[model samples]
Target: MKRVSCIDIGTNTALLLIADLDTQEGSIKPVFHKQTIIRLGKNVDEQKIIDHEAMQRLISCMTDYKHISKEHDVQQIIAAGTSALRDAKNRMEIIDEVVRACGIVIKTISGEEEAALTFSGAVAGMEELPETFSVIDIGGGSTEITMGNAQTITGSVSMNIGSVRLTERFFSSQPPSEEEFNAAKEEINRHLTEHLPPFFEAREHVYGVAGTLTTIAAVVSGLEQFDPEKIHNFRLTCEQVGNLLDMFRRQTLNEIMDSGIPEGRADVITMGALILHQFMKLLGTESIRVSIQGLRYGMAWKELQKLVSDGETTNSA
Candidate 1:
């Protein structure tokens, strides 16, 4: 019952999960979880830095996570940052501030590395995955697409089209009109056309991971509680996604928040739907299996293996 923790600081959200890993079973599962939505990249494009407002909020959350990790007697924490910090002009400044305030040094990883790690995590949890599968990781500020065989990753691409950026640039107005949604869809299609050729040319089963795809799972399942097991391997039809987009557009923001959906998720849910719809169209896949595991899970598993290996050497000596 040894515990480990991982912190994934993405553009739209900062997630922390501390799990009691039964590595003796060759699988990793989280017994405890904590997440905070600081929206770190709130205005990075305009400010050229992590916004001060968002940083303050993140500091508060990270400070709280620090306390929780200690209280739980957790050891070995790995932290990473995604698109926002990757593209920001003042990323180091923000990273310094985070380290200063919370004792967490966040690594801003490249999109390719993000794709590879996510693939490793997704593959680890699956009963069976296709030999020629495509894995897509959609985030707040970027998306990573990997083409892989059953054994290893073949090639990958990371694009800057993400839920938050797309929503901000195109669907800023709530309950976006058809014109707005189409414009965003067209842009997403254009980007996909330009960037996704190698992965899209030959596809088997496309696995989707991240909040966007999971929200689709949530909407389709209509579950008030977020259940990873139920959503994992769940598929949604293109027509179903399209229909939901249409219906979602008719509802106001207040209506969306008032529903069973969590308040922190309200702002980008529609935009996330739009992104996934376009991805399905471009891949010509009617449906995609939801991957509940991503970077946080990946980081934890990697660290756990290293720890167990080190422990074995110590015991032998």
Candidate 2:
């Protein structure tokens, strides 16, 4: 059993997953999984750069992840930066700083690659998923919608509309005003309608991944603490999503935070919910199945395959 560490640095959260890869079984067993919301894309939409304070927060989180990975004796560390880093003008500065501080190199991945990895990770262990379904990853900086089955990806699209970006752009008010909410909804609809392919609407089974969807599932389930087992494969109907959106819309940021939503996510949960709501409406799905497995899991699986392939080549030679 070889321990490998995979880090996914996104706009809102920095995630660390350390797992033991069983080469013979081609499976990854999780040893540790943790997430810290550093808001790396806090103002990237407006400023086009990762802010100084946000970068510091991200580095702090990475330092903690590095310590944890070392404690677990991880053999290989794969760190990836998405959305925020992809859009940041000074991403290299941030990357260089991270390497200098934590000795971890972060790879900035494109949106298409992000979607593919997310799809692979989202369905990795779920045996009940429909043959043809959709996977939606709503991050702080971008939203990736991938349509695929167990075997192959049919089509995918990555849109610039995300929770942090939308919140900053439209919902500046604490609890967004009706006008702001409608404006954000309209914007999300416009992006999906104009950019997403027709196949997205045609998919019958849709699985929601990432923080926004998972957090919403946790809140809706009335959990005092977050639990992945309960959240994974959870189902949320369009009506339920609408109900939650209305519930969130009426509450202030503090109230939402106190109501079991993650500490740093309260301000943007409204916009996050709206993103999910609009997508469900556009796709005409009654509900979405929530999958806790996401990019980090997919990245681990991909890395394991590469390692195994290299080993096989060496043996053959």
Candidate 3:
């Protein structure tokens, strides 16, 4: 089968998906997907540029991805850059370097576009999208919230309150102190309150996507091997969120790292979870339905939909 790939380069991670696309009854499905943590935005918010080490790590990842695609005979690819790219001063230079080194073109999409694409991806497998479903895609550098119905969009907002960004901005501790955690949560809640009210009003279900949410789902389900099918659409209650947050608070970063989390994730998972917990509390939501689908899946599905609508075969460009 021919393959289509989507690469999402965010502040904290770089994700790659190579899928065999299928179109039947006006629906598209991805057959394969993979993700990695590159932490491109590691210290960008503080340093103001994609740091040298982070840039090199990213280049290596992209080079490997390009080679893998070639080995698989894959041709069609969509590469997108999010928050860090949007804010970096030397973004053009960074983009040029990636293209020269990896043979891949990267497009930096707007916040609204990110939210919409994520919403499309998250809702792709659902039988019916709610009239007022709030889809949240929380990244390392930013968070996107989209409120919409089955056929039309209502409002979309992207905020600069992600795991990496938040960790650097506040709670600079091995394990965040209660005072620090409370202060951090207050800041998040304050920032969110300004923009979230319009989006949260009359919302029915909250579908959370991206690394933070999925990681929480994985830990919650106690899955030895990550299973999206088993956890996607699974709800996490506020009480459950509080319990997990408390559990992580008791364990140090090294302990969590030693326990089982991927090394790259040990640093920021707690920060991400705390932010998520506050968001859920602010929205007065008891639970959130997980969506393994996100921006990369959304972008690929959009292109596939255009192809199918134009009555073209699932052929690669």
Candidate 4:
């Protein structure tokens, strides 16, 4: 078994997952998981660049993750940067800085790859894996929806519409105006109608991942703080989602936070929630399963596959 640390640096947050990979069994046992909200994609949608402050936060967050990985004595550190990096004009410069200072290479992956990885991660370790399922990962700068099964993905699409992107575009105030809300909704609908693949239609089983879904699950379950145990595999239905959206529309950022939403998440939660709401409407599914494990976990499993393949190649050589 080899210990591997997988870090996912997203537009809104950075997550770390340290796991033990068994080459023989082709499985990964998670050791530790940590997430920090750095909003690395801050204003990337508008400015098309990762600003100075965002870069600083990225460096600092990676430094901390590096230290934590060392504490676990991991054999390999795999880091990935998603939509935030993909949109930022200075992404490579920021990634290089992380490599130089934190000694961690950050891979800026395409949206297609992100959706595939999300599908893999969402279904990992499921006791009763669905025959076929779709994964919707609502990120800060983009949303990835992929349809797949236990074996492979059939289709996937990564939309440029995300919570942070929409919030920044339309919302200048907490609890944005009704006009702003409708505009955001219209934009989301436009993206789905134009780009979403037909494979998603009639797919009953769906999994929701990333901060938006998990946070909504948390609030639905009435937890005082973030709890992964109660979150994983939790059911989020269409009715509940609609009610939540109505409640969010009535509440300001501070009010949302005071009601137990995670810091750095409450502000954008409404937009995120709206994305999920519209997505469910398009799919015609009553509910979706929530998955806390996402890109970071997917990266860990992919690394294990690579590690095992390399070992086989080495032995044959």
Clashing residue pairs in candidate 2 are: none
lDDT of each: 0.79, 0.88, 0.81, 0.88
Per-model tally of clashing residue pairs = 0, 0, 1, 0
> How much lDDT does candidate 1 score?
0.79
RMSD of 1: 2.6
Task: State the lDDT of candidate 4 residue by residue for 42-65, as single tens digits.
Answer: 899999999989999989998998
Give stretches of model 2 more than 4 Å off.
312-317
> lDDT by residue for model 1 over 103-161, one digit each (tens)?
97788999888888787766665776666888888888888888886577888888888
Error of 2 at 261 (Å): 1.1
Expressed as tens digits, the lDDT of each residue in 1-317 for candidate 2 is: 57889999999999888988776677778889998999999889998999899989988998899899889888889999999999999999999999999899999999999999999999886777676888999999999999878888988899999999989999778788889888888899999898666656445798889999999999889998898999999998899889989889999988888888877898889889999998888878888999888999889989878868867323210
TM-score, candidate 3, is 0.94
Candidates 1 and 3, the one with greater lDDT: 3
Where does model 4 exceed 4 Å of error? 312-317
The superposed Cα distance between candidate 3 and the true structure at residue 163, in angstroms, equals 0.3
Worst 10 contiguous positions by lDDT, candidate 2: 308-317
Candidate 4: count of backbone clashes, pairs at least 3 residues apart or interchain: 0
